[model samples]
Target chain A: MSGIRVSLRGKSFPDASGNGTRQVLGELGFVAERGEFVAILGPSGCGKTTLLNLIAGLDAAYEGEIALDAAAGNAAPDIGYVFQNPRLLPWRTVFENVCLVLNAPAGATALVEKFLAEAGLTEFRDAYPEKLSLGQRRRVAIVRAFAIAPDLLLMDEPFVSLDGPTAERLRAMLLEIWNACPTTVLFVTHDLDEAIALADRVLVLSESPASIVADVPIAVPRQERMAPAVLEEFRKRLRQPEKV
Target chain B: MFHLHAIWPRLASFFLFLLLWQLGAMALESRLLPLPEAVFAVLRDGFQSGEIPHHIGITLGRVAASFVLAMAIGSAIGIAMGRSRLLDRLFDAWLVLFLNVPALVVILLAYVWFGLIEAAAILAVAVNKIPNVAVTLREGSRALDRDYLEMAHSFRLGSLRTFRHVVLPQLSPYFLASARSGLALIWKIVLVVELLGRSDGVGFQLHLYFQLFDVASILAYTLAFVAVVLVIEAVCFRPLDRRALRWRR
Candidate 1:
C-alpha cells in the first residue's frame, strides 16, 4: 500500500512588481493513509498547485519535510501526476506518451495497449496528441497516470474547463482506474462540488499562505455520490469552510 | 504523381533561368560571358578527365567535416548555456564577439596559428560557423516549455530519458533550423578555406583557372558545384526535417 506524510511549514516566491517575497503555502500538514483518496479544496491562487509541487518533489526548496511511503521500502516512491493540462509530449503519439511513464518502455508496451484499450483510446494510439480532442487527451493523461501503478498519484484540476458531459465521463473513468489501482491520491481542485463527488475526504484551505481550515470527510457512499439529494446534504456541511 | 504539381514549377524555374542566361550570353558576345553549351562542354570534359570530380569530392569532404564538428560542439554549448544562468552570463559575451568577428579573419588566424594544414582549413570553417548554431539552439533551449519539463519531473523520468524524449523533440525545430543554415554557411566557408590554403579542391581549381582567365571552366565548376550542393540539400536535409517534426501542425 502507498501513503504520504507531508508537513510543509512555508513556501514563497518573489513578488512580480515588488522586491518582497510573497508567501504561498504556510504551516500546512496532512497525512494520506495507504490506499486513501484525499482531495485538497481551495480557492484560486490559494497555493494548492504549489502544495502539489512540493509533495510531488518537483520543488525541493520548501521549508518543511514531505515524506512518501511506497509499498516498496527504501526506494523513492513512483509518483504519477495528472496536470491541469494534458501536457503530453507533442511529438510523441498517444501510445508512446503513456509508454514513456513506464520504467521499461519497450518491454512494457503491452501495458500501454491494455490501458489504451480500457480507456477506449486504442484506435487513436498512433495519433499525435495534437490530433486528439480535449476530452480524448484528458483520457490519455488519466490512462498514463494509472498505467504505472504509481505509489502516489497527484492530480491538479485535471478535468477543468471541460463541458458537463465530458467532465462527468472522465471523472467516471478516473474513479474506475483508482479503484483498481488503489494508490494514494492527492487531488487538488478549486471546485467544491467536484471534491464532494470524488474524494473520501476534502481538506479545505484558506487564502494565500494557505493552511488547512477544515477537514470534512464525505459522509456519502461511493455508489450514491452522484445522487442529487446526497450531494445537497454534503454541500450544506461544507457551506462555509472559511470560518471552520 | 501527386508531387507533379510541386515539381512543375521547379522545372519551369530552371528552364527559365537557363533561357535568361542564354539570352544574356548571346547579348554580351564576350569571351567571359561564354554560352551555356560551351560551359557544359567544359564541364563534360572535366568530368570525363576526373579532375573536376576529384576536386568536387575534396570540397564536399571538407564541408561535411567542418559542418559536423561545428554542429556537435556548438549544440552542446548552446544547450548548456540555455539551461544554466551562470553559463549564459559567462558565454553571452563570447558568443556575440565570435558572431561579429569576420570569417576571413578566422580563416587567416587558423592558418597563422595552425599552419596551412588540412585540419587548419576545417577548423577555420568550423569556428566561423559555430557561433550561429550555438545562438539558435540557445534560444530554443530558453523557449523550452516548462509544462513538459514538469511532467517529466513529476513522473521521475530519469535524466537521459527526459532529454531524449521531452527535451530533444522540443528542440528538433531548432536543430533543423541550425543544420539548414549551417550547411549553407559551411559550403561557402569551406570553398574560401580551400581557395585560401588547400591545393586540391574546387576552390583551389577556381583559383588556378582564374590566373589563366579560363571563363568557361570557371563558370562550369561554379554551376556544377552549386548543382551538387542543391541536390544534397533537397535529398538529405529537407526530408529529415519534415520527418523529424511531422507532428507539428
Candidate 2:
C-alpha cells in the first residue's frame, strides 16, 4: 500500500467565483496504482472539478501538500484537461483544433489525421464547430485533449449534454482509447452508472464544500463492468443517504 | 441584389416629390426653382460638355484619399482602445468631445490651422470618423470571449498564429461594420469639408452653382453625387460585408 504510485493530499482555497474556502477534498487522501482509472462522483455544486484542477496543477492556492511520485522519471506526469463544455474554437477547423497540441512535434498534418481518424472525425477535418452537432463537437474536444498523449488525463463531466445512448457510446470509445494509451484518468461525473462503467474505483463526494464520503472499488473486469445488472448494484450503493 | 420591390413605395414618393417640385416651379414661375426636366437637361448638357467628369474626378480623388486615411487611422486607434481599457479611458473624453462637436466647426478649425490645403480637408474628415470606429470596435473588443483566449493559451499558439487563427477572425465582423459606416460618413464629411475649405471637389462645385441660384445645375450636381454614393454602397460595402459574413449560414 505504501508503494502505491500517484497521490495528492491538500486543501485548496475556493475559487473567486464566491466559492467560499470550504474544505472540498478535506485532507483528501487517495492512492492510484499505475494505469488506474478513478471515477469521482458528486452532486452539481460539489468541488469534484476543483479536485481534478489541483491534480492537474491548475490551482495551487491550497493549504495541504500534494505530490506525485517523481522518482522514476525526470519529468512529472504530462497533464491534459477536457473542460465541461466542448470549448472548441469556433474559427478553427476540427483538424486544426486537434493539431494545436503538436507544438514541438513534427508532421502536424499526420498527427491531426491520426486523431481525426481515431475520433471518427476525419470527414470533418475542415468543418468548423458551428457546423458540427453537439456530439461531434464533444468528440473533437476529447480528441484534442487526448491527442497530445498526456500521462494523466482529467475530464470534468465531459458529456453532460449528450443523450444517454451517445454518452454510453462515447464512454466505450473513451475506455477503448484509455486502454490503448494506458494513462491515469481521473474522471468526474454526476452519473453514477457512468462512474461505475469506467472506473476501477468510484469515489463519491458530498455536497458543496465537498469531501469524499466513500471510495468503492470495482472487482469486475472492464469487459463485464458495464452490464445492466452490475451497474444496478453500483447505483444501489451510491443511492444510500449521506452521514454527518 | 438591389431589392426595388421592397423600396417601390419610396421610389413612388420620390417621383411624386419631383412632380410636386415641377408643379411648384410652374406655380411660382421662378428660375431659382427650375422644373425637374430642366435639371435633367442641364445634367445631360454637362455630361456632353465633359466638364462633369473633371469635377467628378476631383471630388472622387478627395473622397478616396480622405476615406482611406480615416479607415487606416480610425481602425488602428479603435482596435488599440478596444484592447486596452486604460487607452480607452484616456481617450474617452477627447473622443466624446469630437463626436459631439459639429463637423463644420472641425472643418473651420482645420481651415484656420492648414489654410484650405488637401491635408486640411483629409484631416477634418478623418477626425470626424475616428471616434465612431473606436467606439464600435471598443464594444466589440469588450465583448470578446475569454474562453477562446484560454483555449489559445492551452494550445501555446504564437502571437501571429493566435491572432490569425483566433482573434482576427472573431473581430472581422466588427472591422467590416466599422469600415462600412466610417467610409460612408468620411466621404459625406469630405464633401462638407471641401465646401468650406477647399476650392475643388463636388461641394465647391455645388457652392458655385448655388451662387448663381441655378436650381437646374444644383439639382444636377446633387443627383451626380448621390449616384456616386450609391455606387460605393453597391460596389464596395455590400460585397465586402457579404464576404466577411460567409462563415454564417
Candidate 3:
C-alpha cells in the first residue's frame, strides 16, 4: 500500500501579546515514510495546540498550505482529533456520542464497539458524560476519536488529567489501537514518560517561539516496551536537556 | 406520586391561612369577602351542577388552541432566527417591539381589528405567547455546540435526521421550559381576553359574578382554574421534562 504524508508550507506562528513576531518554525519539515507514530513534546503554551489546530482545520487563520498525499479524485484523508479535554457532548449517552461520528459512512456500530471495548468502556456505553468518572470520560473521548478510524489521529495531552495508573492503562490501550489500525499518529504531550511509552519518535520543542529542538527516535524494541530497565533508560534520556 | 407526607406542612399552612381569612370575614360581617366555608359550598354546588366543568373546559380549550398555535409559529421563527444571522438582524427590531408591547393593549388592538370574535381572543393570547417561545428557543439554538454540528456535517447527516438526533434533543429542555412558562402566560391572557370579549370561560363567569356581587362564585371559578393548572403541571409538563432530562440522573 502507498504511504500517506502531510506538509505545512510557510506557516508563521502568532506573536505573544505586544511581542514582535518571531519565527517559530521555519519551513519546518518532517515526513512519515509509511506508518509512523510521532510524539510532539513541548513546554506549556508553546504552539503545540496551535500546530494541531492548523492540521485539524479547526483554525484557518494562518499563513500556510497543508497538503495531503492521496490519489486524484479520492477523498481527503480523514483525521480524528482527541482534544486535551474529553469535550464530549454532556447531553448524549456514550453510545449516542460514538454513533454520531458514524453518520458519514454508514454502518459504524462495529467500529464503535471495537474502540469502546479496547478502551474498557464497554459496560459504560449507556452512561452519560456527567455520570462517568474522570478517567472513564477520558476513555470515552479516546474511543470516540479512534472509532472514526481517521487516516491521521492527533491526540493532544489526552491523559494529562488522569491518575498514573489510568494514564498507563490508556497509553497501553492507545498503542494497541495504533498497532491494530496502524494509523499515523501525532500524539502531543507534556509528560516525558508518556511520550517514551507510546511514541516511535519523540519530537521535543523549544520553550517559546517553539521549534523542533530534538527528534529522539525510540531504540527499545516493541517486545520490551513495558520492561522496567528499558523504561528507566527512556526516562533518563528524556531528562537530559538537548543542545539548544 | 402525590408526596402528600412531604407536603403536609404546606397543606397545614394553607389551612391556617384559610382559617384566618374565614375569621376575618366573620369579624367584618362583609359580603365582599365571603367566609371560606361559604366559598367551599359555592364550589361544591358549582361542580355538582357542572357549571365549573363547562367554564373550565371552555377556558382550557381556548388556552390549548392559542398555546399550540403560538408554539408552532414561535419555534419555527426562533429556529430560523437562531440559524441565520441575516434573519436575526432583520427581525430583531420587530421581536423587540412585540415583546415590549403590553398584552392588554394587544388584546384591545385585536378587539378593534377582529371585533371580539373567538378568533380575536385566541389571537391576542397567541400574540402574547409567541415572543416568549421564540426568544427562549432562539437563545437555545444559538448556544448549541458548533463541534457537535461539525460532527454532524462530517457524517453527512440529512437535515431532518440531524434535527431529530442532534438539534432536537439539545433543544428539548429549552422547549419544555418555554412550554411551561408559555402555558401559564397563555392561560392568564386567555382569561383576560375572554372577560373583555364574548361571554364564556371562567373569566366571563367571574365577570357575571362581579355584576351580582357574588364573591363566593368568583372564588369557586378561580379555584377550578387553579386545579386545572395544577393538573396540567402534574400530568403534562413535569413528566415530559423528566423524560427529556432523564440522562442527567
Candidate 4:
C-alpha cells in the first residue's frame, strides 16, 4: 500500500523581476489514502502543478512535512510521474526510454513489451518522441509511467491539450492500468469533468495562493461515471457549490 | 545516397576557387605566389623524398594527443561546473581568464616552464583548447531539459544512469560543436608549438624552407596538410556527426 500525507504551511516563488516574492500556496494539507486516486482540480495558474511538484518531493523549499509511506516496508515509495508533456529523450527509442527506468534490464524486456502492447504502442515501440504525434507521445508517457508499477504515480495534466476523443480514450487506458496496479495516484487537472470521471476523491482548489475550497467524493460507481445522467448530476451538484 | 546532381555545384565551386588562385598568382608574377601546378609538383617531389610524409605523421600524432586530452579534461570540468554552483563560481573566473589568454603566450610559457619537451608541446596545445571546449559544453549542460531529468529522478533512475541516459545525450550536440572547432584550433596551435621548439614536423620544414626562400615547398606543405584535415573530417567526423544526430530527423 502506498499513501501520501502533506502538511504545507506556505510556499512562495521569487517574482520574475527578482525583487519581490509571490506566494503561490498558503496553508495546504491533505492525506491521500493507500490505493486512492485523488484529483486536484483548480483554475488555470492556480498553483496546481506546484502542489503536485511539492508532493512528488521535487520542490523542498516549502515549509511543512510531506510524508510518503509504503505499507510494504520499502524505505520510500518509488514514484512514477507523468508531466503534461511527453518529455521523452528524443535520442532514445521508446523501448529504451522505458528500459532506462527499469534499472534491472535482465527481466524487464518482457515487462516493457507488455506495457507497450497494453498502451497500443507496440507498433511505435522503436520510434523516437519526435517521430510520434502528440497524442501518441502522451500515450507513450503514460505507458512509461505505468510500466514501472510505481507505488506513487503523480500526473500533472497529462492530457491537457489533447483533442476530446483522444483524451477520453487515454483516460480509459489509464483507468485500465491503474485498476490492475492499484497505486496511489495524485492527478492534477483543471477540468472538473475529468477530475470527477477519474478520481475517487476530488480536491477542489482556489486560485493562486491556493487552499482547498472543497473535498469532493465521486459517489457514483466507476462504470457509471461516464453516463450522461450521472455526469449531469455531478456537474449540477459540484459546480453549484463552488460556482466554478 | 550519392546524388550526382548535388556534386556538380560543389565541383564547380572548387574549380572557381582554383581559377581565382591561378589568376591571382599570374597577376602577381612574384616568387612569393607559386602556381597551383608548381605547388603540386613540389608536393609530389617532397613525398618522393619521404621528408614531407615523416613531418606530416609527427604533426598528426601531436594533434591527436592534444585533442583527446583537451576533450576529456574539458568535458569533465564543464559538466562539473555546469551542475554545481560552488564549482562554477570557483572556476568560472579561471575559465574566462584562460579563454582570453593568448595561445602564443601559453606556448611560450609551457616551453619555458617545462623545458621544450614533447610533453610541454602537447600540453601547450591542449591548454589552448580546454577553455573553449569547457565553455561550449557548459552551455549544453546548462540548457539540459529539466523535464527529462525530473522524469529520471521520479523513476529512481540512479545518478549514474541519469547522467548516462539523460545528461550525456543532451550534451552531445555541444560536444560535437566543440570537437570540430577544437580540431581546427589545435591544428593551428600544434604547428606553432612545433615551429617554435621542435626539430621536426611540417612547421619545422616550413621554417627550413623559409630560410632558403622556397615558397613553392611552403605552399605545397600547406596544401598537403589541408588535404589531410579534409580527409579526416570526411572519414571520421562527418560519419560520427550523422550518426549522433540521426534522431533529429
Candidate 5:
C-alpha cells in the first residue's frame, strides 16, 4: 500500500457567531506513510477534529485538496474512523454493530469473530450497547475499526473521558492490535503523554485557526516510550512557551 | 408470572367500574340507563347470532386500511420535510391547514365529493390522521443523532444500510407514538364516518338503535368495540412497544 498524502492549504468555515469566516487550517500539510502512526496533539477546540473530518470525507465544504492514494489492486484505500463517542447503534447487538460495516463476503463472519475475541468481547457478542460499560463500548468501537482491515485509520480522542486505569488498558490494547496489523493511523489528542506513548511522530497544533506549530519525532525505543523519565521530558518540552 | 400480578389491579378497577354503573342504573330507574346485566345479555345474544361480530369485523377492517395508508404516506412526507428545507417550507402551510380543519368537515366533504363509497370513508379517516403522523415523524427526523450519521458516513455504509441501522431505530419511538395516538383518533373518526354514510359496522348499528331508543343494545355495541380496542392495545401494541424500546435499559 502507498502512503496517503493530505495537503490542505486553506480550510475555513463560517463562524457560528455570524461573524466573518474563521480559518481552521492555514497551509497545513502532512504525509503519513504506510504503516506509520502519527499523532496530532493540540488543545481543545483547535480544529483537530475538523482535520480528521476532511480526511474522512464527512465534511466537504473545506478548501484545498485532501486525497488518499489507492493501494495496489484496490479501488481506493479503505479508511476507518473512531469518533469521540463509541457511536454504536443502540438497537444493534455488539456483533451486529461491527457487522454493519462488513459486506457479506466469504470469511467475513470469521473475521468478525476474530476481532471480537481480540477485544475480549466474545461473551458479549449478543449484548446491546446499552448493556455494556463505557470502557467496554469503547473497546467495541476499536474492534469495529480494525475489523474492516482499513488501510488508513483515524481516531478522535477515542480514549477521552475514560478513567486512568481503563484508558491505559485501552491504549495498550490499541497498540497490541496495531502491532499485529500495522496501518497508517492519525490519532488526535490533547494530552502530550498520550501522544508520546502512541505515535512515532507527534504534530503539535496551535489554537483555533490552527496551524502545525511543531513536528517532533520520538527517538525513544517503543518499550521505553512510557518510562517516567521519557514521559517527563516530553511533558517538559510540550510545556515550553515556544511550543504553545 | 409478574403479568398476573399486574392484571389483578386492573381487574379490581374494572369490577369497581361495573359496580358504580350498576348503582347508576338502579338510581336512574329510567329505560335510558340500562343495567350492566342487560348490556351483557345483549352482548351475549349479539355474539351468538353473529350480528355484532360482522359489524366489528367491518369496522376493524376499515380502521386497519386507513391506519396503514395514513402511516405509510405520512412518514414518507414527514421524512422528506425534515430532510429538506424547501420541502418543509412548501408543505408547512398545507399541514397546518389540514390540522386545523375540523374532522367532521373533511368527512362531510369527502362523502359529498366522492359519494358514500368505501374509498371516501377510508380517505376521510386517513386524511384526518396523516397530518398528525407527518408532524410527529418530522420532529423525530430532526432529532436524529448526527454523530451516528457521521459514523455511518465514515464507514461508507450505503444509504439503505444507514437507514436501517442508524435512521430507523432512532425513529421507531416516534413512529410508535404517532401510531398509538393515531389509532385512538382514527377509530373515533371511523365511527363518525360510518355513522354518517356507511350501511354496515358498529356505527350504523348504533344509529339504528338510536332511532328505537334501544339504550341496552347501544351500550352493548359500544362496550364490545371498546373491548376490541383494549385487546389490541394489550395484545399487539404492548409487546411491540416493549421490543422496540428494550434497548433503553
Candidate 6:
C-alpha cells in the first residue's frame, strides 16, 4: 500500500477571546514516506491534536498550507481518524457502526465481518456500543478506521484512559492490523514508551504553541523495540535537559 | 391475554370518577349536570345511529393531518435554524411571537383568511404546534455531538450518510418529544378550529347540543372523544415510543 506525504507550514489558531493568536505549529513540516508509521509525541496541552486535526482536515481555521500528496496509483487519499474517545454512534450496533463508513455494496458485509473478527469483536458485532466495554468500543473504533482502507490513518491517543492491560492489548491489536494492511499512520500521543514501542520514528514537540523539538528515530530492530536496555537508553537520550 | 392485575387499578380509578360525578349530579339536582347513566345512554344512542363515529373520524383525520404537517415543516425549519446563525437570528423573534400568541387568535385568523375550508382548519392547528416543535428540535440540533460529526468527516462519510448515522440518532429523542407534545396540543387546537367554524365534528356536535341544553349528549361526545385520544396514546404512540427508544435499554 502506497502512503501519503503530509506537509504543513506555519499552522496557527487564534485564541477564542479576541486576544493574540496561539501558535500551535510554528513552520512545522514533516513527511511520512509510503507505508511508514510516524508517532507525534508531546506534552499534554501541546498542539499534538491540533497538528493531527490539520492533517485530517477537521480544523481548517489555521494559517499556512497543509497538503497531502498521495503516491501514484492512489487518486484520493482517504483519511481515517480515531479520536481520544471511541466516538461510536451509540444507537447503532457494532457492525452497523463500521458499515457507516463503507460505501454501500454487497461486498461490504464480508469486509465488515472480516474486520470485526480481526478485532475480536465478531461475537459482539450485533451489540449496541453502549452495551460494550470501553476497551471493546476502542477495538470497534480501530476496526472502523481500518474498514475504509484509508491511505493515511490518524489516531489521537486511541488507547488513552484505559486500564494498563486493556491499553496494552489494544496496542498489540493495532500492530497486528498495521502489519496486515500497511498504511501511512500518524499517531499522536503523550506517552513516551508507547511512541517508542509502536512508531518507526518519534517526533517530540515542545509545550503549548508547540514546534518540533527533536526527531528521534528508533534504530533498534522491531523485535527488540521493548527490550529494557534499549528502552532505558532511548529514555535517557530523550529526557536530556537540553532537548527542551 | 390481558393482565387483570395490571388493569384493575385503572378500572377502579375510572369507576371512582364516575361515582363522584353521579353524586355531584344528585346534589345539583339540575339539568346542567347529567348523571353518568344519562350520559352513557346518550353515548349508546349516538353509537347506534353512527353519528358519533363519523364525526370522531373527521376530527381524527384533521388531527393526523395537522400533526404530520407540523412535525415535517417544524423539523425542517428547526434544523435549518440550528445549523445556520443567519436563519436562527432571522426567525428567533418570529418564533417567540408565535409561541406566545393565543391559539384561539390563530384559528380565528386562519378561518377569516382562508374561509372555513379544511386547509384553514389544518393550517390553524399546525400553526399552533409548529413553534413548539421547532423550539424543542432547535435545542436538540444545538446539542448534537461535534465529536461524532468530526468522525464522519474524517471517514469521508457523505452528507446523506452523515445525517442518517450521526445527526438523526441524536435528534430522535427530540423528534419523539416534539411528536408527543405536538399530538396533545394539535388535537386540542383542532377541536377549537372545528367548533369555531366546521360543520361536522365532535366539536360541531357539542356546539349543536349546547344550543338545545342537551347536557347528556354534550357530556357523551366529550367522553367519547377523550376515549379516542386515550386509545391513540396507548395504541399508536406508546408502542412507537418504546421502539424508538429501545436502544436505551
Ranking by DockQ: 1, 5, 6, 4, 2, 3
Top TM-score prediction, candidate number = 1
lDDT string for model 5 (A151-223, tens) is 8999999999999999999999999999998889999999888999999988888887787878888888878
Question: Model 6, B179: alpha-carbon shift in Å?
Answer: 1.1
Worst 10 residues of 2 chain B by lDDT: B149-158
Candidate 1 lDDT, A51-134, residue by residue in tens? 998887788888988887757663777888998899998899998899888987778888789888978999999999999999
How many backbone clashes are present in model 1?
0
Candidates in order, interface RMSD in Å = 0.8, 2.7, 3.1, 1.0, 0.7, 0.9
Best by lDDT: 5
| Residue pair clashes in candidate 2 | none
Q: Write the per-residue lDDT of candidate 4 for residues B179-235, one digit (tens) a residue.
A: 999999999899899999999998888888999999999999998999999889888
* Alpha-carbon deviation at B134 in model 5, angstroms: 0.4
- B139-206 in candidate 3: lDDT tens per residue? 99998887767545544455876798779989998899899999888989988998899698988998
How good is the docking of model 2, as DockQ? 0.35
Query: How do the predictions measure up, each by TM-score?
Result: 0.97, 0.80, 0.84, 0.94, 0.96, 0.96
- Relative to the true interface, what fraction of contacts does candidate 4 keep? 0.82
State the TM-score of candidate 6 restricted to chain B.
0.95
CA-lDDT, candidates in order: 0.90, 0.76, 0.80, 0.89, 0.91, 0.87
Going through the candidates in order, state the TM-score of chain A alone for each one: 0.95, 0.86, 0.85, 0.96, 0.95, 0.93
TM-score of 6: 0.96
Off by over 4 Å in 4: A240-244, B19-31
Regions of model 1 farther than 4 Å from truth = none
Docking class of 1: high
Residue range A94-201, candidate 2, lDDT tens digits = 877777666654666676687678888889889878899888888888888777766667789988989989998888888877777677777899987888878999
The TM-score obtained by model 5 is 0.96
Docking class of 2: acceptable
